[model samples]
Target: MSIRAIIADDESLMRSGLRLLLGAADDIEIIAEAAHGAEAIDLARELGPDLILMDIRMPVMNGLEATRTLMAQASHPEVLILTAFGTDEFVYQALRSGAAGYILKDTPPDELIHAVRAAANGTRTLSPSAVESLLGRGTTSATGLAGGGDGGAGPLGAGNPHTPDPLEPLTAREREIAEAVAQGMTNAQVARSLFVSTATVKTHLARIFYKLDVSTRVQLALLVNERR
Candidate 1:
């Protein structure tokens, strides 16, 4: 099936260019485009695309806030953050905001397309330029974003214990998977690194999500990275 997508940015030219490039992909379809974050949310609710290309610094609302809110609501789409700044802080914040992946705005067409496909498939990837910023970091260098977005409506907060230990519930194997994911490894890479099947990796991730009380991969990464 074709991967349905939405492009959310303030720049008309950026949106136009992305529309042209993504439109060329035979298996991809651009169902909607938004000029700012708030519109992105409304469009996401109406269209329910499989993926969203979110840009930071838009008027009315910013991508970070939009991503946080979208993942909090029902029918939330996977968010792939595209931003001008690839600093460590931005990467860490985006992941914590429940973005499925982070990529630089100026990334090459091929890699951008690949990132979109990966996000649709529940995988995380970084723009090559953004990779160096996070290379040696074992955990988040700053505070994590607001809670929820992973499971349900502010789900992590409602019943979570005061001073809750996010990783306390995970098994040794599940911890390994969470660490791999936090380090920005895709499922295929994690499987190869562990000498396991891709299916095994997904199985472990599901358990990790349940145990960690996160609804998405991005939130799980945030939890693991928070340990750092």
Candidate 2:
């Protein structure tokens, strides 16, 4: 099935550019566009698209606020934040808001499309620069941001001496999947490497996320990096 998506951005040119780029993908269909977060939320309710390509820093409601609102619902489209800002604050906030993925506008066209598709399929996506920002800051930097700090009690609680080893619960297969994901492999990539179906890989990933208590792929990668 083709993935239905909405492009939410304040700039007309940016939305147009995104439409042009995403339109080229055979499996992705652009259903509508929104100028701000509020409109995006309304359209999401009305259209029920599979994915929402959101932008931060809008006029009335910013993307982060919109993301938090949409995700709060029992059922909502996956939100993939596509923005120019890659600052640590924006990146952290977007992830915390339950964005399915975060990527800078400068991301390559191919990678951006992949991110949208992956997010639509319930996979976490993060641009290389975003991943770099998380890694550069180290896992502890997210302690306060992720509501950690009580000796490793949050999504990014790795590296805390008092925290039980997060990786302890993973079965060998789960560990392999986690490592592959941390290495930036998509679900499809991990599936191929493990000689399993994509659905199987996704199932493992879900379990991995629960066992590790991490929400975003960036957090999982950070924990894996800290381990290594």
Candidate 3:
């Protein structure tokens, strides 16, 4: 079955251009389009697309609010932000709002298509570098640990604020998987890159998530990018 998608952008030309570009992907089908955030919400409930290409700025309601609202649903589609703003604040806000991924509007066509495919499988669209470029090197939690509420200290076992953060507890294999995911590779992509099965990739991701204390791939990307 094809991955259903809804394009939500205020500009008609932009929507048309995206429709043309996404048309090339065999597994993606454009089931609906919206000019604003509220309309996107309506369509999401009505069509239940697999993905939503969301814009930050829109009339009626903004994409951030809409994303939060839609995510509150029992069966929500993955939301991917497609916007010109790549600021760290915007990226953080979008991720916190439950967006699956954040990609700049200037991304190459090939990458954009790949991101859509990846997002269809619940993969994050932002590269680690892209996440870093947009936001500060900080953890999502108040404790500065990638995992929220966990006061993580480095291998040195020193809790002093001045002590360097302990190395993340990832095995060599898990590290490899995190690196690939930080680069915005999907589980299938990571599996192919590592010559492993998708099931194996998922297993590693679970371990990585527990080790890093991040629930989402975007936060994992941010954590890994900070180390680079």
Query: Which candidate, 1 or 2, would have the higher TM-score against the true structure?
Result: 1
Q: Please identify model 1 stretches exceeding 4 Å from their true place.
A: 136-165, 171-173, 180-204
* Overall lDDT per candidate, in order of appearance: 0.78, 0.80, 0.75
- Cα lDDT of model 2 by residue, 117-211, tens digit: 98897666677677567655554233222211111222333455765666899999999988777665667778898999999998988899789
Candidate number of the best TM-score:
1
Supply candidate 1's per-residue lDDT for 5.
99
- Better model by TM-score: candidate 1 vs candidate 3: 1
What's the true lDDT of residue 52 in model 1?
A: 91
Q: How do the candidates rank by TM-score, highest first? A: 1, 2, 3
- lDDT by residue (1-228, candidate 3, tens digit) is 898999999999999999989977899999989999999999999988999999999999999999989877767999989998877678777876777777888888998898888777775557444446453534332222221111222221214456454335888898888767655566777888899999999888888877866656766755665554
TM-score of 1: 0.76
lDDT of 3: 0.75
Query: Per-candidate TM vs. native?
Result: 0.76, 0.68, 0.65
RMSD of each: 7.6, 7.2, 7.9
Top lDDT model: 2
- How far residue 18's Cα lies from its native spot in candidate 2, in Å, is 0.9
In model 2, residue pairs whose N, Cα or C atoms come closer than 3 Å (at least 3 residues apart or on different chains), thus clashing, are: none
Worst-scoring 10-residue span by lDDT in model 3 = 141-150
